[model samples]
Every structure is written in structure tokens, then in C-alpha cells.
Target chain A: MAVPEVLLQSGVSSLLNSINSVIQSLGVSVLLPIIIFLIALAFRVDVLKAARSSILIGIGFIGINLVIGLFSENISPLAQQMVEVTGITLPAVDVGWPAAAAIAFGIAELGVWMIPLFVAMNLVLFAIGFTYTLNVDIWNYWHFAFIGGLVYMSTNNWLYSVAVGLTLGLFVLVAADWTQPAVEETFDTPGISIPHGTSAPYAVAAIPIHWAVDKTPLGNIEADPDAIQDRFGILGEPIFVGLAIGLVIGIAAYSNALFVAESWYAILTAGISFAAVMHILPMMVGILMEGLTPLSESIRNFMTSRFEDRDMAIGLDSAILIGHESVIASSLLIVPIAIVMSIILPGNDVLWGIDLATFPFFFALMVPIMNGNIVKMVVTGTILLIPLHYISSAVAPLLTQAAGSAGFDLAGRGLITSPVADAGSPATGVLALIPAPVALAVGLVIVLGIWVALRMWPQRMYMVAGASEEKARETVERRHTGKGGGLLPNKLGSSADVTAAEGRSDD
Target chain B: MTTKNILVVCGTSVATSTVVKEALKEKLPERGLDIGTIAKAKATEAPGKVSSGNFDLIVTTTQLNQDKFDIPVIHTTAFMTGIGQDEVLDDIAAALED
Candidate 1:
């Protein structure tokens, strides 16, 4: 039902006006939020040091990409050209360099591809493992990228992508340490520190060939199951395969979508989404560059930095988990949201534009949920789909069609397809659209759910955390026993201190 | 009394950086930090300005490419905004005794 014009309303026009004024007044000082954030993290903000590092890494990566963009429009082409110069290529027949990078970017951004990929990869791996009876089971390499895709792709969003990359990078690093088996285990270097210098070695790989090789040999191997398991479990090969398939299909559809010959919005949205993905996960080139060198030290440092602040790291972990769940649940609401949007889209088609990309992306996320209770997700998806057609049908006619039988523009009724103005107007630039009250609310639910999930960890993790502190205590203790250990006496503490530190979110 | 000052900087110093700086000022004092100059720190002058005599430390989410720095510089993750605020303050407070 249309909102009755009498009761219906638009955002306070003054508020919009003031926002524009504020944007103007801030001058370029507006850049300070992220800038100050970096500076604050560098100089003032006292926690989540590793997360700070992740942000820097991501921002730095993007900054570089922006510079690279200065020279080229499509990053994939540049990535591919780099490969030809290197004289190497990824062997995966069906999936090539451009597609791989695009797939990585897609998975990292969308969180949708993994749904189908997860199912298919698992089935194929086990079936092959079961059929071949192979001990070197054909699975488990995608510790970060897979999860990046499963969690980040589908939605194909930026905030979530950065959030996921940082959270995942930090978690893998910390979890790598926390979950690493004790001295009793065979491999007891204690710290599988992935040295510093390189940032998110896995996610940021620009070359496709380097992408797979970095993981294939396992240079910095650690002894553990939880992290390794969780890492692989969430992402696994299912995601890679899924994204690979999705791209072929998505690209084809996207190509078709390009031709749908509708408005610029559809084409623009798909183009932007696809382009963003390619930059993130450039294909075979990264794989070709693969090999272990002195880079381990940098890798270890990067990982350690990733988990520098115990407090903020956990909080971010909490946030990512929430974002994940939000992606899951909000995904369920996809159809409903789309239904509502379609109504608004068509009538206002010529007049204004909403960031409707979220709708189709959300629809894509349901692929996993679709597998669960296929009927429910499908019903939800359709309910969402019907609205697009509804609004399109309703609005198209209003702009050009007569107002006879449908009564879409009736007097007693509220605004129909053609409302007077866009609610989200003055929303120029990607920045303007971000902090989307709507997206944030959904993110909050994800956070609430993550807090609930944090409780489910086994008591052993508490033991592990205790063990961690005791281990640190031992280092501190040994330091006292000899030299440097006692040096930071004021700084170091025992298992209790570590646990206390871990529990507090205040960094 | 030495002002436990910090310089928050980023490219353009626009919106997100401001939110981050304000958040720092609001929270830093409680941690025994005498917060000052939460203004825009230009990327070009970021290190030279921050590492000079005034501020005790530099906390930033932006990536700085310098090989070495005079003062302790913490780079925050853009992905994790306001994440390292408290720890950053504490580290600076720890640095004051030096």
C-alpha cells in the first residue's frame, strides 16, 4: 500500500540542505575521519594495533590501486599485462587470470559465491577423497581467501570487504598463535609469527600465479586444528570453485545485464561491482610469483601486527562475525527489501536513483540460505522479486500510462510509484551513501548475534587463553630468570592478566 | 606538564578522519592523556610534522611508507576504525616517562 500523501513525508529538506552546507564547510578537512583514524592509530588510539595495521594495509592497497587506476581503467588488464611481462600464467583451464582476480574480488566483496561453491567443493573433494581413497586429501588450502569470499562476497560491498579482510587477517594471525599446539606437539617454535612488512600476503596478492603458490607449499606452517579447521571450514575449496563458476555465470549474465539495454543504473552497478572484484583478486599472476623467501619475517610481522591489540582484535572479531550473520539474515530479508525497492524504482526511474545494488546482491546471498530451507528462501526471494516488477509496472505507466483501472495515482491514496523526491538525495559520492542508516542497523543485528556466538567456544579455549598467558608469563618469568624478561616487568603479566586483558573490550 | 599530544592525519583529512579524531579527543582524556591538536595531518607532512618536537606519539590508520621514524608511529587499519584508540593513548602515556 502506498503511503497516504497526507501522512507520507520526505526527509526534512533543511536537513539535506544543512548536510550539503556541512560538507562544503568541512572543506577538504572532511578527509580527516580516516586520516585522523590512521594518525590516531599511529599516535593516539591505544588499541587494536593489528587492526590498525590491517586498515593501513587495505587503505594502502587501495591507494596503490588508485594510482594504478590513474594509468588504467580496468585493473584486470593491467594485472594481466604484468603476467605477460613475467612470462607465466595460471594453469587452471576453465578459470584464468582475469576471472580469478575477479572471482577473488567478488568473493571478498559479495559473500554470496561461497554458498553454492561451499556445497559443490565439499562434495567434490570428499567424493574424490572417498573415491581415490587418498591420504593427502584433495582439500583445505584456502585459509583466508575462501572465508573472505564466503563472508565478504555475495553482498560485494566495500565496508564489509575491508571489515572482513582486517578481521580475517587479524583473526588468522591471532588464532594461529592461540590455536597453535603446545610444546608437546611436534612443531613447537611456539610462535608461527608471519613476520612483518607484507600486508595480508594472501588477500592483497596482485598476481594470479602467486595467489595459489603462496598457499600450496605452506612456508609458515603451524601446528593446530581449530583455526586451521575453522579457516578451511568457512572458506574451503567450495568457495573458490563457487566463485569460479559464479564469475563465468555472473560475467555472462553481467554481459547480458550490460545489454539489457535498460537504464544506466543496472549497467553502472554491475560494472562497478565487477571492476572492484577484479582489482582485489587478480588471477594467475599472483600464483606465478609464488615462493618462500625472507618474506616470512614480514609475513610474521604483519600477522603479529594484525593481532597487536588483544581487546580491539576480539571486538573486531565480534564485528566481523556480526557482519557475517547480518549478511546471512539480511540476506533472508532480500526478497522483502527488493519488493519494496522495485515499487520505488520504476515510478521514480527517470527522476532519482537509490543504491539499489544492495538488493540484487542480497538476493545472491540467499544462495546459501537457499540450500538450507530452499522453499523459505525462495519464497522470500520471490516476494522480493515481485515488488521490482510491481513498482516497475506501476511506475512505468504513471510516467507514460493512464491512471484508470490501477488507481495507482488516486487522490485519496498516498504517493504511488512516482513520489515527488528521492529520500536519499544529495547523496553524491560513495562516501555520502555510506553509514547508510539502513545498512548499519542490519550490521548491528549481526553484531548482537556474534556476541551471542562468542559464548559458544569450548572451555578449552579458556584453557588455551590461560595457557597463552602462562606461556607469556614464562617468557616474562624466564626474562626475570635471566635478562630482558624482567626488563619490562611493569608491562608483562601472567595468564590471569592475559585473560583479563582478553575479556576487556577497552584495549 | 608535557601535553600528551597526538596528530591524527590522513589523505585529504575529510569526514572519516574527523569522526576518528573527535572520538579520540572525547575518549583520550579519561586515559590520562592531555589530548591536543586533533587537526588534519597532511600525508606529505605527516611524519615530519608528527615526529617533530611537539606530540608524544602518532596514531594513524593510513599507511606511511617511511623506513624509520623518530617517534613511535602506530598505523591503524582502515577496516577497523576507532579500533586502536585506547591502546594508542596508553602507549603515548607510557612514552611520556622517557
Candidate 2:
């Protein structure tokens, strides 16, 4: 059964061309779901369920993209206006996460094999009891690929890129595990973990920093968003807070316009736009969640059943985690801080633009470390941004080079763009710069040290008291079951209660 | 039948409020209640908005300080997770009827 070598080569080339054509025609929105469906089939999930889940994921991505689009459209103008009014010209324009992800996905060397390889690695890690997270946010695989692509370009070697990428991915999974308990405690939800590209690693630094802050006299001062809301009334609400901040930014952005006869309302209009964003973005997220929940639920259920003895969490996007009021409020506070830091923080050249909209996402994990205290969260977030801006500036050249290799034309625009514009700030500045093996070893040691420290002094790291988690669950259940306010009808006890009950008992 | 004004509140008064508002729209009509205006506010806005304006009921996802509000406050976590939704609607119906 000998086949000619030339014919085999031709057949292989044709098959690759066909895949490339399909990918080009459909793009990620359509291609991702199809890939998910095929993977689901490979996993032996029921055809109908797999198809439903795939379609749901596609819808979720679409919903998320629409929301992001709306947010960018609304926020970008104000950011631009602010830069114009202030005369703050930075050398680099942050192309933000979408562009960065595009560059990562466009890398020909990592094409098609990325998700499958990562999944295989995840399964191996799971089987070996190395990680509790089953990473389902396949779309975000670009983060790892981005690192790999960067390494490959730098060294002109595929092995280095692959090594760095896989190492970074594994490190994120471990970080997800490390932060899960705090996420559950802070958010008061269970059965999920966030392994987002940028925010997850920041949590490692945040934990130690927050611990230090707790020792200060400020520790007793609980200025959380909820507390602020209760105390300050309207000023504390995200909408009003957004309005006030937006007004300041608008006035600063349009100072010249304001002095002119026709543009007096520009500042007020800016405030209204920001206020509208406060209302609109979350609703969009809610819509996106409606699509994501079904998929996460199916995955969670399957994993829970499969791993009967062990507690398993489906790792999802940070978008799922950012819906908390405190997180949003804290992020709103950070926006102006980030802007101020960008200007005053020496050696920073990246201009704030579309990426400012991602502040809520950036602070999602940090809120937990601060125990949802807005005051502490703001302080820590502000301090974090100092390094972030510098690192973003530092990586501009590499990012610009990568953009060129990936086909983004920067020669004509007079602006270099950094992919680290949003999520990769911590990565470039901290872990990603190190040699792969060294980074992996250091990451593991630090994680282990923190893990041990958490075990020894659970309260120090914002670990929930055992009794409180139970109490919280009971409170939720009692309210649902008609023992408390009985807000829920008696018969259809919610899936939330069932899940809460399951989580509480398992612990 | 007198027109009833219901105020729905959540953490940010955006995402969950929209969901709750939509849910109440369907449920309130099902209960055969005459509804006038359905409004949404952040939980912080409840005290001022509730005190200044005449509202029949306040439905919130977050637990509110009922003593500060003159109107009945119904607290439910149903809006965020879409769980225990029937109970939340039933409770809303009961609050409106009362």
C-alpha cells in the first residue's frame, strides 16, 4: 500500500488550504463555535447538547462584542477629548485587547493546534491533580499564543515560543486555583474560577500588597462601595460617580470648547455619556451572560459529576466576575487614577484611549484581594497602574514589531501600538520577560509559598471564615425557601439555592 | 384600579435592574395588576428617590434597609442568577396585591 510522496504532499497542502479558506470566510465568531461543537463531539457529549452549547457560546461572544463595541464607541471619544484638552501627547496608542488577540490568532505557526494542545495539557494536569480548573475560555487562548508568538519572533525559534506560551498558560491555571477561595469569598458565589489573561496574575501581587495595607491604620477603615453607597447616597452610586468623573474628564477635555459660545454644553454632554455607559455596559454584560451561563452550567455539571470526590470549577472569562457593584465602583475610581498616573508617572508614553473601558475588567480580581473595600481597592489599583504604564511603555517597540509582523501598518499612522495596552501590562513587566523555564520555576515557588502562607494564616489573605460561607448560603436558601422574606415562590426553589447548598455541603 | 408605580433597584442599577424590570413587566401583568410606570435606580438612589417620589413598591436584588424606606422593600437575588425566579415574581405579586 505504497502511496507516492508527491501526491501525499499535494493532498496535505490542499487540506491545509481548505481549512485556511474556511477560517478566512467565517472568522472567529463562526469558526470558534464550530470548533467547540467538533470538540464536544470528540468528548462524546450528546449531539443536541453539544450543538446547543456551541450556539450559545457563539451568541455569548456576539453579545459580548456588541457590548464592547458600544462601550468603545462611547468611551473612546471622551478619552481622545481629554488628551486634546490636556495637550498630553504620548508616543504610543494602545490598540487594546481586541487587536492584540487578533495578532496572536493570526500567527501561522500556532494556528489550529493551539486549542487542541492546550486542552490536552489541561486534561493531563487535571488527571495528575495539578489543577482544579478546567479552562473553558478557549477564545482567550490568544493570550498564551501572544506570548508564544512574541518569544518566537524575538528568538527566531518556534521551540522557545511554544515553551513560553505553555508555561504561561500553566501558570495562569495555578493562579486561578490560588485565587479561587478568595473569589468565592469576595463575590459570595461558588463553582467557578476566573483565569483571565491580565487580571489573574495581578491577584498574586495584590494579595501580598493588600496584606501589607491591612496592617496599616487604614485597615480599620472599611470604605467599600456598598458602605460608601450607604453613607454618601447618590454620589456613591456608579452612575452618579461615573457622571461626576465624566464631568471632570469632559471639562478637562473640552476646556477650550467650553469657553467658546456654542460648546458650553459639551462638558455636561460628556457627563451624560459616561453616565449612560454606566447603565448600558452592565446590561450588555447581562445579555452576554444569558448566553454564557448555559454553556458554563453544562460544563460545570459534567465536571462535577465526573470528578465526584473532588471540587471542580469551570474557568471562565473575567467578564463573568466583573458584574459585582464594588468591582465596577472600584474600577470607576481607578479610571481617573490611571489617567492621572499615565501623565504624572515618569517614563510613560502610552496614551489612554479605548483601553480605559477595560478598567472594570482589570480590577475584577483586585477587588477580591481588597475584600471589596473600594478605598483599599482604589489605592492598590492606583499603585499597580504606576508600574503598568511604565511596562506598557517599555514593551512598545516589541509590540510595534509584532504588529508589523502580523500585518498592522504603523508606518503611516505616526503611532506605535502596544498589545500590552490593557491585559499584557503585568505580563510584560513581570513574568513574561523572564526566560521560560526560570519564569515557570519562580512562579511555582511563589505560588507554593503563598499557598502555604494561606493555609497557615487564612484570615490574613481574606479567606472567608468557615461559618460565614455556611451562613451566607443558609441566608440565601432561607430567603428562597420562604423562611425569611420568601421572595421566591415556595414550589420552584431556585437553581442558585441548589448550587449554593451543594457548594456549602461539599465544603 | 389605581395606577401603581414600582421602583426596581440593584447594585449598579443597570444590569440586574434591566433584567428585573423585564421580569416584573411580564409577571406584574400576569398577576392582573394595573401598572403605571416601572422605574429603576441604584440601591443608593432608593432612599432619596423613594422618599421624594410616591412609590407603591420597591423591588431590589440587594438587601435594603427597609426602615429607611416608607414603602415595602422586596429583596431577591433572583435577578442576577435567574434562579428562584418564580418565587421572586410571586413575592412581587404578593407585595403589589398588599
Candidate 3:
């Protein structure tokens, strides 16, 4: 009788607690907006805008994190490492909060693979929104929320931190452009920028579908997103060059005796190497294509999905989601071609200084988001270097300590052995090979650098593009106005500037 | 022939330098040099980890002032990354006139 009574009380208490938690969440989501509306009714629209912006920011944070958590789960080795951290044996779960957040952050970044694209997209959107008086503050609101979401997400969804940093960098660049109204910005709120002559109906549909437009005209070419997608599509120039860079690295690695053994797979070493280095997809393609390499398939699948979605959104054939997988594999042939040069002159030491090489690699990876602004990318890179260097230094020693006798792995120990943003794994499995002390140091620095870079890169590009595009639109307006006076952005940070160049990053 | 050594000076002069030193020792015989290849245990700033007169040649990523050493020096972009490792090695061989 006594045991049954105690059990009953405990169950009742838990049920009550869970109910209260759900109620609190619902209240915050529902009541908070109503309260803000009441306040807006009494006060100014700016304050109400501020409240609405905060809520959207909060929601964006929650949503982005949800996606990141989902995607990060798929990184097989990382999941193993997380289990190691907590000393738990359960496999990481997808289709849940964790993986969703990871994917969202990764998708939002859109820079790690194509930095210029990220920059151009944000700039184009900001320009359109600001020029037309759409919900302009959503830009700033999301930017700060990203920073905040990043703080939360980094601690939990460690693997996505690198992508998060890229996102933040882009956000900062966009935020810089929000001073006053362009000739098009009749309204000040984000997403509500009412451009000259475009009424309410057009602004609502234009903001989200800015880049995903179906059929745009030449004079109306700013909305010609099909052209934008083509700029960075699988057949684009960057993927081709990247494949060459990979082939060079692969052949160099091979001759250096990286392959398991010469007695084994040497039939067409040159051809094989090129195929492996196929630079069509950086970070994912080469890792995935390797047969024996230990990178997890799930994470690779996610990357493949992201690249596909990106191609789709930018106006590639929306119907073909998984079609680009073949493109990634076939394009890998270029890596082998460039790598053959190494065999001809195998005597040269092809190593670059770590700082010089990786800084650029990071910047190159970020160039899409910065929209081909090498100067802008460099500025962001420089700002991030000191902190990143210190973090790497600190993490190295700690990793040395944690490594014990397992041989401290440097970069490229397959995919799962490494952490994104160098997040420390749960204290078991693969990451356990990386000692806790070193992992901590690496984790902090890597995450910080990635997040900072992401935000800075995109933010600057967006501002420049938005300002420029506004000018272009005005000039077009003037020409039509019969005045024929001068009024184009004429430089970087213009509104239409975003669409003018989406994937033309030289750096 | 006088006995000589080549020191690959780097920033930390630890892990990567160690790897370079080992790779050089293995690869040098092919170039017909029986001389020992050692990683100088110093950085560009504190390159005095090994004695100045101790090495017959200095190889580094960045150039040293050479006011302190009489040995032949060859610097290339190899120590920090894997980019020009082979090219830099050829440069060193060329410096040796072998």
C-alpha cells in the first residue's frame, strides 16, 4: 500500500511539471506577440517593430538551431564522439531537433562551398527589400539572432559551428547597410521595404522568391535568378578550378606515400588521383568518393542535399534534387588531370605556410559569401586570424595531452575523427583519440573563427550590394521618369550589385 | 669533402620540422649526398637553438638575415604547408650544385 501511494505521487508530480513547461513555452510564443501588439497600439511603430523583430529573431534562432541539430547528427564519427563525451552508447538521432538545426545552419551559410553566392544572395535580397520597403528589419533582426543562436547552437550543435560562423559573417555585412532609406525604401521595417511604384501585393511575394524567380526579363533582369543559379551551378567555373586545386593536392599527397601501398591500387594512379580530388564539391565530394576512407555517409548525404538545394533555389531545375550527385562524381575527373603535373616535377616541396594556405582556404571557402570581394574577405580574415591562431595553439597542446599514445591526428583523419569548429566530442570513441585539453582549445578557436568569418564576410557584401542595387533601380526609375539624371550606385555595396555578380569571387 | 649539415629552421621547430627532418634524411641519399640533414631547433625569430657555425646550410620558409651565418641558405614555401615542398627541395638541391 505504501509503495503504490509513493509511486502514484511521483507520477502525478512529473505530469504536472511537464504540463507547466509546455504551458510556459506556449505563453511565450502566443501571449508575447499579443502583448507587443498592445504596446505598439499605444506606442510608436518602431518600438512595435523592435518587439516583432526580437520575436522573429528568437524564432529564427530556434528554427536555425533545430535544423543544425538535425544535420550535425548525420556526421557519423561526430555522433560517435558525442557518445564518447557523455560516455553513452546510443547512436545520434536524425529526424529530430539536433539534425534539423545543423542542416539549417549549414544551409543558411551557403558560403563554405561558395562564399560569393552567399554574399550575392544576401546583398540582392537586402537591396530589393530596402529599396521596396519590405520587412527590412528582418535582415538586422536575423543577423543578431544568428549571433545569439550561434552562441546557443555552438555549445550544443558543435559540428555546425563552422557554418554558423560563415552565416554570422554574412549577416554582419548585410547589417552594415541599414542607415536610412534608399530612393526605394519608403518603409523602414525589414521585409516591408516598399519600393517606388510597387504596391503591397508585389512586395509580399517578391521578398522570399527574390532569387527563386521563374521567368524574369532583361530590363527587369535583377530578378533574373535563373542567370544567378547558372553562375554557380555544377557547370560553373569555380567548381572546375576547385577540382584542379584538389587534384594537385591529391597527387602531391599520393607521391608523398599517402596511399596505403604502391603494391595495391596503381593501375591509373594519375586518373585515379584526379577522380578522387574532383573539386566539384569541396569538403564533401573527395571525402565521400573515397572507398575505404572512414567519412560517414549520412553527413555526406546532407552536404549533397545542401548543394542540390542551393542549385535549386538559385534557379537550377527545381525538380531535380538528387540529380547533381552524378555531376559531383563526374566532375572529379579534373582533380586527376592537374595532379599529373606533380609526377613530372616530384622534387619540389609544395607546402605553403599554414597561416598563408589555410587563411586563404578559409577565405576561399568564404569568398562566395563575400561576393568576390577579396579585399572584403581579407579584412574579415585578418580580424579573425589572431584569435584563431591562439585557439589553434591552445588546442594543439591540449590535444597532445589527450592523445596519450594514439598518435595525435592532424587534419584529414577521415571525416568522423575530426570535429566541426573543432567541437570536443563526448569523451569516447573517435574524438577520444583527441585528448580533452587539446580538443577544448581547438574547439573554442575553430568555432569562434568560423562564426566570426561567416558573419563578417556576408554582412559586408550584403551592405555593399544593397546600396548598389538601390542606386541601379533609381537610375532605371530616373531614365523612365524623363529626367535622365545620374543615379546608379556606381560602386560596391549597391542594391542591384548583389545580382550583378553572384559567384565571381577571385580570392 | 668536408662534413656538413643542413638545418631546416621553422617557427616551432617541433612536429613539422621533425617530419621534414625525417623525410629529408630518407630522400637525401637519392640526391647523392651522404651528409646528415637536421631540423634546426629554432624559429625565424629564435633561430639560435642550434649554433650558428654548427650548420653548413640553412633552409627555411622565410629568409634569415644571414649576418649571423656564413653557410649557404635556401628558403622556399614548404615548411608550413604541403604546397611547394617538392619545388623547395629542388631549390635546395640546386643550391648544393649537386
- Candidate achieving the largest DockQ: 2
Residue A367 alpha-carbon offset, candidate 1, angstroms: 37
- Count the clashes in each prediction: 98, 4, 110
DockQ of 1: 0.02
Candidate 2 deviant stretches above 4 angstroms: A1-15, A40-86, A91-127, A131-200, A211-227, A230-258, A261-289, A311-333, A350-375, A393-428, A433-441, A448-507, B1-98
Q: How well is each residue in A1-507 modelled by candidate 3, as lDDT tens digits? A: 899999999999999999767545553324333433443333234454445433542343344333322233323233344335443332211111111122222222221122222334444543432211112111112222222233333243434433343333332322222211221231112211211111111111122233232223311322222333234344333323433443333343344354566512432333333333222112221111121011111222222333331211111100011111211222222223222321232231111111111111132122122333333333333333333333333333332222211111212222211111221111111112234345445544633453343233433333332334544344333322332112322132333332445645532
Across residues A1-507, which tens digit of lDDT does each residue of candidate 2 receive?
356887899899999999878666665556656766776666566778677766764664454455444544544565566677787656666655655655565455563346667777776676655666777666556678777766666666777677667766776786776566667666655655666676776666666667777788777776556554355556655567557756776677777777685454767776776676555554543433333333433443444455555446567566545546676567656766776777787777876543564665567777656667777777776767777787777666666666555444344343444423333456655545666567556755765665444333323232332124454444333322442211212223234433444456644
Which lDDT tens digits does candidate 1 get at residues A1-507? Answer: 556543344446666778767654542212222332343343333445434433433343333233223213332332233234443221111111122122232232222222223323323422322110011100111222332432332344555544443333333233322222221121122222211101112111112222233345332332332233234332222223233323332343344344565523533443454434333332122221111101211222333343343211111111111112222333333423443443354332221111121221222222222222233433444443433343333333222211111111122221212111111111011111233344344443533333222222312232332234345455333222332211122222223343355676444
TM-score of chain B of 2: 0.89
Q: What share of the true interface contacts does each candidate keep?
A: 0.01, 0.11, 0.00
What CAPRI-style quality would you assign to candidate 3? incorrect
Selected candidate, larger lDDT, 1 vs 2: 2
Every model's DockQ: 0.02, 0.17, 0.01
Chain B TM-scores across candidates: 0.70, 0.89, 0.69
Task: Report the lDDT of model 2 for residue A198.
Answer: 68
